[model samples]
Target: MAQKLKKNTAIALGNFLSQFKAEGNTKNPDVLNNNLFYDDFTDLIALSQSHNGWFTPEQVYFAIRSWAEALTEANLNEWLSRYDFSNVQPKTVGLILAGNIPLVGFHDFLSVLISGHKVMVKLSSNDQKLLPFLAKYMISVQPELEESITFVEGKLENFDAVIATGSNNTARYFEYYFKDKPSIIRKNRNSVAVLDGNETKEDLIDLGEDIFRYFGLGCRNVSKLFVPKGYDFKLFFEAIYQYGDIIQYEKYANNYDYNKAVFLMSLFPLLDNEFLTLKEDTSYASPISSVFYEFYDDLENVKERLKNDEEMIQCVVSNNLIENSIPFGQTQQPKLWDYADNVDTLTFLNKI
Candidate 1:
């Protein structure tokens, strides 16, 4: 397979994805095969939440828009340019995808093919529809892609390598099973934000988006906060109040009520803003509708701790407080080059 063909196909796929946005779906007259695929995609967006309660049209649109923004010709070229794909001997890469958020496995699927390999994908039950649809659309753009993509319903076999993502427990199983093959087994990781009491209300509001987008389902969502020792809750609560309507959603309301009850039952003191709860906890992972927080006395200590616990973190949000940290509200809008878990997927695929 010529890598350029795959890259151009990806750029075309990006254009197709770009049509569906949070504002609304607007068919691009220039895109290929709108007659066949556009209406079906819109229907999928409208009904996604019925199949999976968390997949509200807004969230699905957000996921599609993220990929749309990412697969531009310029962005794809920059991300793929660092590696040499000239002599890549194609291999079949088996993928065990996770469904935590919409199209969570797309990067892996894209990596396998764009690096001159075939992919056999096993879709997560929660997210089975979106990727396959796009795969078909891409194949429509270029007939050659039909031979390179496969979706498996049974045990994954006939592949030289595998990539799997799941909880820590599943990671163990993936390790033991794929031990014979060169593989990348990903486990759970969460994002966190560090606050220095100087962040403006605008910054905190954007941080609210980082926290509430996707109902806090994505690994990129900020689930914990590191705040200065004397930080006040007044501004933080006020800034995030825009998302208060999130409690109106039944699923999120249930989580808010349940998690709050559990915290109260455990006698843990919490700072509540009615819709969201803030608990003083050291752990990085926080339940839905609740964000765990730790008070820090020194910025350097927080930095050192994050360095030591790097494996457990996916993204760190700070306004230049931490080196290499992502800016507030932009976690969900990661660039094409931003590899998940900081594992360079493209490089790994090239080597295999």
Candidate 2:
């Protein structure tokens, strides 16, 4: 029964997602105007920015299209096929979501439900609207799901386990609070890129998406770079120059101006490309509108360093320079199975 419900639910989600494709002007006839979801979706795209300044229509649409591609029956089945659910007992799993990016916590919501558990979600205030709207659509498609999904506004209670994502500070609070419960508490982590100075212009341009998408708010965004000594920034800066218009956004421009001023006041040298700034630093988490970089003498030593610091890194992007690193452009486009912090939520849920 759980398998059937989840499979049908994936189809329903896919159908709903099919309406937002970039290459097509088509809407699913079955999902007519009377359903009110389509109209609401249109309104979401229009109002997302008003709700959260960073939730621009383009970012929201990209998120929608990415989910649409992920929710297909084949992908869902392939992801779920590895798990054994016959002995599972349904438990209420509580979620404390992060609002760094649109629908960032949707995967956790999906994991709880598809694993035959009830989900009680505490939506991040910055991203409160869209997921619940989609949850309504899912419930409409599968009435059984209504009993399995709950959105909580206050304290998360009456749950067997918890999954929470937040910064290093909030994580400390979560850990002490939920210490008694079986929980997955995610703390601050950042992604980095390794460059050998031989990358083509197209590769560097694509790498811009890894840096600037969602305005660099996501953990998957490449916040740092590892470059060889004396690596020239000319071609790399030229390639990413196309994204210079990003400075036009007030919030981003404000950050750029503020962070640049802070750096200059400290007398730190920087490589400025008008829109994005590159600073020489060893940290993994860089502020918005800036990417910190470190010089590496040997790829072997850097790989070992990353291995030792794996907990602080979410992903590594490169042209296969390091084994297991993600591609240059695809950091944010994670597969459903690419669990954050390398924690397997499904396996954890099944165990509990």
Candidate 3:
């Protein structure tokens, strides 16, 4: 079964890499175009807008490819060689995918398959398209894997282990139902950036991707910024203004306008562009508030405070001031080695 899984992984990697060449023929000029699941990508911009916010289809395609390549035979074999999965059964794992962002559940899906476990995935209604499409393509590439993957529309029971992702509110329900089972239940988490006064204009512009990508919906998206007391917000705002075209979406524009009006009614101060709203807040989960940044006087003091607020912070974006942090734009592009919640996912699955 391990050898078979390795063959399936290799085939899946080949199918995914083929997409890079296919992208040229699938171009559209409209930014607000829709990218349906089964069809070739059209209206790249619109397809991106349909997700959470506006990101180019090229960006989304490359991101997916990056993830797929990480699951290749070479990498998987190296990881498995170091870990013992001899006692792990091949048909006892169930994965409940999160639909908050495009292909958000791919990592969990890949983890289960490469670790010698059958995955019964419950697709999020909001994102029912992409994963199944990829699954179909994968099965085509390696017909033997057809028996290992199943996409179910209803509840699953008697699984030896489960990995579920949900809001902090739904996390309680997951805990109650899967308590006796070996599980990885993920609650809410948000990403943040730590900015010092020394950041270049280019750095701030790149930082914009962390905040505005997918309209700040993904867990990796930066919903808040921690800036030094004397830091200038204008420079930061100007740097990201190139993405102003995202407001062309009537829905996104409506959100920006509505949030701006609410702030005005409440006499709250803010900075605005055609597509995004910026405010001063400590919260990392912003509903309609596109970009919320807060000022801090000291970096050391803020780091200490963050330790107490770890649940709210996922990745910290910084250039030089914060040690052991990712760069301004690298938050969404996690390496294969970086596990969610710092958990050893393969080991956890092996134990189950």
Candidate 4:
């Protein structure tokens, strides 16, 4: 039964996701032909904001498109090729999803299914609709998945292993509770960028996408920066002006105003461009609509610091300054194999 999981099924799922990428209420012709799925998608777009204020139609569509691009037959095969599932036994894998960004847990869902494991999903209240709807689509494409998926509401039990994602505090509880089970307990992590002052204006513009997308809510977003001493901010600010419209959203505007006031009250100097604020702080987890920056005289020292604090960091964004750092505008656009925290989920499932 496990080997019956076919690559064509993955491609069909990708094609289904591709239909919802267009911005606004428009639907692809193929999607419109499926009456039930089309109705569900339209309702998803309409009610997403009410479910989670950050889940605007645009952001949800962005998430859908990203998954659509990743789930192609070639991408799926490439990602799965690294793992040998020849001896995978069907065990139930429990998932505790996060709701920081729209469909944030879809990657885990996809990983479990493709690896030939039954998944018991406990979705975050903030992100309830999208994944389950897609799960229905998956069952429609491959009926075998219908018997392997379950969504729990109260407590997570009756599973062989666990893969839980939560904050550092909740992680402690997960560690204690799942002590007897083979598990992957994820904790809080944030991404940072290294700037050498030699980057082009275009690079800075793309970097803005890394910061503002998802309203700086996802773990992959660059919430901190490492800039050389005396780096000029004039060009960076000018290039990121296109995202200034973010302040128009009331939720983002409120957060920006509140965080900016807090900075001013603490007598901290900041570089503000009306919408986004940059403060000289050493912390990696900055609030919404703001990014924390620290000055560095030596790139090597910064690299050493990042190495020492690797667990606290998610992805590194740089223009060839930091080794293996993600390219600008690509922190959020991770490939199918870019496992979170660099922990291979497929291998974990195989062993469990």
Write the residue-wise lDDT of candidate 4 on 1-352 in tens digits: 4543646666777777777764544455664236657777777777899999999887888888898899887798788889898888889999999999998998888788878889999999999988898888778777878888999998998999999999999999999999999999999999999999999999999899999999999999999999999989999999999999999989999999999999999999999999999999999999999999999999999999999999999999998898999999998889999999999999999998
Judge candidate 2 against the unseen true structure and give its global Cα lDDT, from 0 to 1. 0.90
lDDT of each residue in 1-352, candidate 3, tens digit only: 6655554555455444434432553323331111332244333323654554433464566556666566666765665566776777676688888876677888788778767888899988767666776666666555777888888888976578899999898899999999898899998888878888788999988888887666677888888788888676788778998877767666567888887888779987877765777788877777654667788877888788778887777788888666677898877777666777667787887777
TM per candidate comes to 0.99, 0.97, 0.86, 0.96
TM-score, structure 3 vs. true: 0.86
- Candidate 2 per-residue C-alpha lDDT over 178-225 given as tens digits, one digit per residue, 9 for 90 to 100: 999999999999999999999999999999999999999999999999
Can you tell me which runs of candidate 3 are displaced by over 4 Å? 3-11, 21-62, 68-82
Model 1 segments more than 4 A misplaced:
none
Q: Please, what is the whole-model Cα lDDT of each candidate in the order they appear?
A: 0.93, 0.90, 0.72, 0.89
Runs with alpha carbons beyond 4 Å of true place in candidate 2? 21-25, 31-34
> Which predicted model would earn the best TM-score?
1
Error of 1 at 336 (Å): 1.1
RMSD in order of candidates: 0.8, 1.3, 5.1, 1.6
| Weakest ten-residue segment in model 1 by summed lDDT | 17-26
Worst 10-residue stretch by lDDT in candidate 2? 25-34
Candidate 1: RMSD to truth: 0.8
